[model samples]
Target chain A: MSTEQQTIDPLTPVLSADWGEKRSWTRAVYETGGGYDALRRALRDMTPEQVLTEVKESGLRGRGGAGFPTGMKWGFIPQENPNPKYLVVNADESEPGTCKDTPLMMASPHLLVEGVILAAYAINAHHAFIYVRGEILHVVRRLQQAVAEAYEAGYLGADILGSGYDLEIVVHAGAGAYICGEETALLDSLEGRRGQPRLRPPFPAVAGLYASPTVINNVESIASVPGIVRHGAEWFASMGTEKSKGYVLYSLSGHVREPGQFEAPLGITLRELIDMAGGIREGHELKFWTPGGSSTPILTAEHLDVPLDYEAVGAAGSMLGTRALQVFDETTSVVRAVLRWTEFYKHESCGKCTPCREGTWWLVQTLKRLEAGQGEEGDIEKLVDLCDNILGRSFCALGDGATSPITSAIQHFREEFEAGMHTPAWELFPYRASTVFAPEVTPA
Target chain B: MTQQSTGTPPISAEVRAELVEIGARYPQARSGLLPMLHLVQSVQGRVTAEGIEACAEVLGLSTAEVSGVATFYTMYKRRPVGDYHVGVCTNTLCAVMGGDEIFERLKDHLDVGNDETTEHVDGLKDITLEHVECNAACDYAPVVMVNWEFMDHQTPESAVQLVDDLRQGNEVRSTRGPRICTFRQAERVLAGFPDGLADEGPSAGIPSLNGLQLAQLNGWGPPPGRAGSDADRAEAVADQGRAAAQATAEDGQEGAVATEASPAGTKHEDAPGTGGEAK
Candidate 1:
């Protein structure tokens, strides 16, 4: 390792390093800051096998909620399958409190564009699709313009940069369906079908998108590719922990003083990130927070110093899924937060699986009763029972994620939920105090 | 988010041609169904039966199949939408952070329930108000979306004021920049068409660049001596590509921190005890 690699900064902004630069999204600014240099190098110097080997050596894990090894995922595409391989960048960043990708796409879409070219090259795929959610109109605009610019610059399309490597990137926009964020469902949605999860014996790598070998990586995961290409696997591997290599954007939101994206190396503690975020909105202490997005179970103040990597968070009863650290103070009620999240899960649950579709509704019903102080004697048990049925029985992670907040909240704050049997959540914690925007007092 | 249809409107020739164009972009014709449906919504203001039939005819899919796809996604409205679609984010994080209060205040101010439209009295602001799920803007919580543009960090008072400004035809802009447009125009953009306004706003807003700004402030960057930052910077300046298309991340306004980002629903931090937004 280089002597300089020993110095680790608390906040390492690689992907986000150019976010503050003026017009960083354009190919001009991006190239000025060494953008497509990775793509140019990849296409000119490396073979598909070589690129694959480099990625696998880097040990970069998926930035999407699932912590799968990204290069290993690229390696899974059966090259001899004869069917054309495909790469899909999942830019559908709709997870609650996970605001990293949308901003990344807005600020530096060429990062994702360059990564797409590099990934498509690595997997020997000519076609790539970036399925951005429809809600963010301007983000879609920035990405579309970036793709067009890449084509003009010869980084995309046939014969890229004097190399005979051919690639096509279609910036597909998704209709507002949280379920479509699921890889299988996103494939179905891409094919103009109802966005339901396909059964996974033939996973996406085997049979995805028109029944071909497809590699689907998250926006952040795919965007991190160019850096790996430009600087080699060892350089990419140098920043993060042993197993979980490289930097991640920790989206600290919800009651934090400076709620935003903190791109730090893997295994950085939430305690350090919170201090960088001006220490939990000034006065309030961290009551509970999610080490990742809302789907991975919530962590209490006890988990403040837990190293936020895949293995560390898993040992601490959570997964480093998306690194969306949603900080909640004591003014927020656990029961109320769990109920609202349960409502989201119920709303988003696709009806393909009976357990998730039916179970989420029942869990919400029980939680609502508890939140309103109208619970039955066994409502908490009933909520857990419903969660148990949905957890493993669902077709996808949607149903599974619905149970995380409810079960974790009950496990940590049983007293507050039990108090919900006779007293309302509003009585214990007034909702208004949790926000700075109180309605102006109207003169009667 | 269910929309009740009034009457089925047939798809126009132009819209049919555009649907066919969208269909051709995909390897499989049916794969273009989502964007085509979005295009139909842009034209008809909702996914009418005729719009579905047009899409089916273009892609050789059955009307039932197209309808199934249409109804599955929340964005494909079944009924007519207003000139603007005002969505209040009532998701978990946003809800506790005053989204519930904002949604309620807008509902009360406009005399509309969730997923309902305001009465078009003399064409002030005809709005379809709905409590939407998260739009991935939780950092700027209590986010209200006007047609898909983010009006971030909204309070009940500001949300109410925003609706009033819209009602009176004041030119309201997204917190990130970009003038507000009809939701139909937004759908058109989402259907793989650009409005040439990608250059309208700040690339990264506060909180988005919060970490980067803080790191720069503290002189923190990509580690002290990691991979080739020095070499890469030199190479970038040497071989910059496509000098013609110059677009800065910021146009006029930089993405500086707007508010101090204290919890909403309180007047001031130094106030004695927590201030109330008592109903």
Candidate 2:
């Protein structure tokens, strides 16, 4: 199951270049390190269409899971439309295993701020909003400070950098709904409604943010823009595979000895990343991992050499989503891991649509039973059947994603689930105690 | 507006003014619902009936609508909460790294389950414990957050000590930020207003900067394949290692000087967005 080490090229640190610098989040540090240079060049030298074309040529896909083309998403906004368009940066990094955006904002808030302005200019947006998750108060404060700094520096507000372009950036916070991470749901939340996903065909690009055409991009997707614009299309396109060009923040968390955000070109393999991460935690051996967050299907050590690009991961039956490589060692139980992820999905599932709202609730109950060794003989098939019903039938990707762990865990480790039917998870991993099942005691 | 509740008084004029300012941030006033709820939570311990009515009136929505939105999000507490809302992330990564054990121990120690507030006992009565989802700081696994500020890399012993300090009314501070505030103070900051403590602490931690540091130590580059010959790369790496070692030495010296200068460190300031001035 061991992957042969390949000669990985020296890592390309693009978005994360300034992350290690002292006081990196401050505007002074950012400006001194050549921040806002791209925004100036794009506004002064290039036309909006030219800026859009360069992004398209650069092949920067959406860093927020979906792998949608960044330029294409902006281009989807109709030029002929007289109504004003809005740009919303999805800073709600709530996916279970995804932790890159929060750190990115914490370390370099100005990078995201600068990127938002460039993105706004490209799409002819006068007002941009950064919808951050409410749970991270520190990050929210950092972003607010960054926006205020941008406004004070004339990078935001009317006629930025003496260019005719004007933009206003608002750093809005979401209460605590994971569904709001879904783009349309985010728009709905931004509009001050119940954070639920809207039906498509309007697709956000056509009608969004107060019924006006809007472009929604992830924090990383927008934050990666200043570099793309500053370095030119060919420069960004030169790295990574053809379809998935440019460097991305690969968040390597969990069992790895060094768990952090690794910014590398798109096509790098997990084997190379593991080597850079000081390999798996000392005595542990890699058992299973997720190429993306928990939403993507789990891949075992057998697939370690798979290039962590969109196409390669997709071909291998998972996605290169957000590149949240959550590695687990042999001591980890597949059933227990899936149950924890399922609990998260169940808790965070917005009761918007039936398949997700109802399906996720049922999944959690079934998973709890299976994990506690109270399942019947047909329970494994029942789990698969339940996943099958919810996979494509849900209103949004949440339901589909909720099924990924169950079906994939079963696909790769059916024996584990079968064993779960006989033995409780606590017996298998004695150290993995949880409060969820602890007996309730009266207060003394 | 819907019938006002007589039990709880209306939000203060300052809170109302702040709500109005927050409402104006959005093109539609309704968009300010979440932040307005946060403001309410900051004022009251949780989203009270009066708070819901105020939010509904501010946004011209029904009380039911406001309540629905408030209760939909986990951050907004429906019941009374402890002064410090301790949320230990028990998600997959953190759980495996003893977050589950930490949570179990805390539950037993406090005699309160998830989402339950402890009975008022001396100074610690306002403690609410919950197993929160990933706080997005998984690199420091088994993370515990007090009032939404990160308490990174927690073990059972450290986590127990944190709760003990909190309960004993000792000055408890976050690992990477200023002294930990009450949950209400943290909520105030979340409501689109800066607490002016933005410059208090290190923005990124060593674990956060680990990958980038490794890259620098290895002489990683922007261009993928053009990292020079092996001998040249090795020399660059050696140079980087020496520079890093020197920087660490200087930092150690500066750290001692800083400790001497600020023996007690700065105290936490309670500056809510009372003025509601738009930044």
Candidate 3:
């Protein structure tokens, strides 16, 4: 095991450094490990502009799939805006393969709390909100407890650390909605409205969170700030490739010996991560994997060594979205996998726009037929046609993302989908006969 | 709030106070809508019409608007739910890892299908089962969530037994944290109240801490040749320098503190008291 570990490169642990410690979530443990030291440095030493400059120099891109520059995002807030500004942390991590944020908050909420303070200070916001998913009550409790500790310890509240900067942090819980992960949709949900994407001429930076200039950042992005501020910008910039700087929390789940969040520098390949994860479950060979989340196009074993950075992944015909690396072995059926992802998109399509709402529904019907081996001739072409219509025509990325697996599976595994067309899914993989489509079987 | 025949009465004084408190946290009262819906679900087992009406009254919105928001979110059930809501995550990853089998097993064991409720199964009453989308705990694939708390790495046999335990009224606890509470108790916690059990046990599991442990055991620090040879040393020096500057800044701002001091407790004034420890 140790020999296999040495095969993978030794990567730095940034956001995940303190995650393993006992009681890492507590304020005492966090502070003892230099938790809020960065916030103190930013508040006492650097001006807001300097802090902004440091982040920009760090070249840290958003970890929430978009890959937008984090510093540039903070800089988008108009400094001279008369209305009060807000900073909203997007903790509603609902992407199919994404699981980093929940664990981060559950294990170390103070890291995020300290980062929120620094981010609010850098962006000159008085109020910050962490909109977490409501289903994870334990995480919400941990965050609320961490916030309460921050207040009692003077990390939050008026005159934080006696720096004369007053900032309030609210830990808000989001009821279940995948669409809310989208920034504009998240803002709408935060404002107590349906979680649907809004028109984006005036983005969230200009008009968000009750018509205030709000900077909505992903939890990983914000949590990365404290380390950047604590260590110099050059320190962060030193890691990763030239363009995509710093480490990211790469969530590896499914069909792996050790499935969890691996905090590696950007541009590491799936081959390396898989090695670190003790390779695929014993005896199974890698068949296919999602480079990011299910939203990103699926990559086969052929693309194992492809660098997982935004530009590289884009060049490879997928986005580096949320770093949700879901691995599947040869035993897994591609058609069944695509069908499950499509069903998720169908269920979560928010019904906001014509293309996503209507397109996802139709796509699911076709995929369901394909998976059940009832697909007629021309079903594959029909699937592609549906994807083409929804890709760019949808109101939001949800529609486009819903098409990723369908289109990508056909690209890589057309034979699997075709095999299912004639033979029932259970027949193709007899092992799943008792489970996959068993619910639809009527009782005698 | 208008009275209704939805079985639940108009919002109680305690619920009204909680709603008002949640509303104050947001700049716009209506922004408190989701938490208010959670509050309603906490008391009514689901978002009843009466609960929606009370939320509308508190947020100064119409019942139609409140209902729309409540219906939009999957967590806000429109009808009464079972005491335990067993949500099997049949997302792509979990489904491939026996989630489908587990879902089928639970349906058979509880005699319920997706989003359907069964009455008086064994000793359990109103056990609602749903094939939930990804619950975001895919690391523990084949995951089942009861009352929104994780039951990680479940097999068909284990999942069936889980429902049986609940049906038999056994003290079923989550893989993490204290003993699993009822669905309503979980709802109240989701509604922004802490159950005070969050501190009882380890919040994370072995899977969660796997990466950090591996990194340490392998002697893997930051990526090489960047961020200085020693990331810890650089951060320590920076911390000490900043700590010195902070001390000087605090000493200099002694008089300014008086002028800049906003009212105490104003920061979290709008935060909910559901957990009672938030304050």
> Model 1, range A347-404, lDDT digits (tens) per residue?
9888999999899889888888888888889898988888899888899999989889
- Cα deviation of A304, candidate 2, in Å: 0.7
RMSD of 1: 8.7
Q: Go through the candidates in order and give each one's C-alpha lDDT.
A: 0.82, 0.80, 0.80
- lDDT tens readout by residue for model 2, A1-444: 111232334576667666655456778767665677678778888898988998988899999999999999999999788989999999999888898999889878999999999888889999999999998888888899999999999999898888989998889988888899999999989988888899998778889999898999999999888877776676677778868888888888888878887888888899988998889866668889999999999999999899999999999999889898888877788888999999989888888778888888888888888889776788888888889999999989999999998898999999888887788876775544322222332334
Better of 1 and 2 by TM-score: 1
Candidate with more favorable, higher TM-score: 1 or 3: 1
Flag clash pairs in model 2. Answer: B82-B126, B82-B127, B83-B126
Please name the candidate that would achieve the greatest TM-score relative to the true structure.
Answer: 1
Superior by DockQ: candidate 1 or candidate 2: 1
Per-model TM-score, in order, reads 0.92, 0.89, 0.89
Candidate 3 at residue A392, lDDT? 90
Two-chain complex of model 3, DockQ on C-alpha atoms against the true structure: 0.26
Q: Please give, as one word, the docking class of candidate 3.
A: acceptable
**Candidate 3 residue-wise lDDT, A84-203, digit = tens:** 989999999999999999889987899899989999999999999999998787888889999999999998999999999999998899999999999999999999999999998788
Interface RMSD of each: 8.2, 8.7, 11.7
lDDT of 1 by residue, B1-279 (tens): 122222334676777888888978878878899999888887778888888899999988899999999999998898788878899999878998899989999999999999999987875868899999989988889799998889999998889899888878799888875899777778888989888888777667887978876765555545322234722442233223212223322323533331211112212111121222110
TM-score of chain A of 2: 0.95
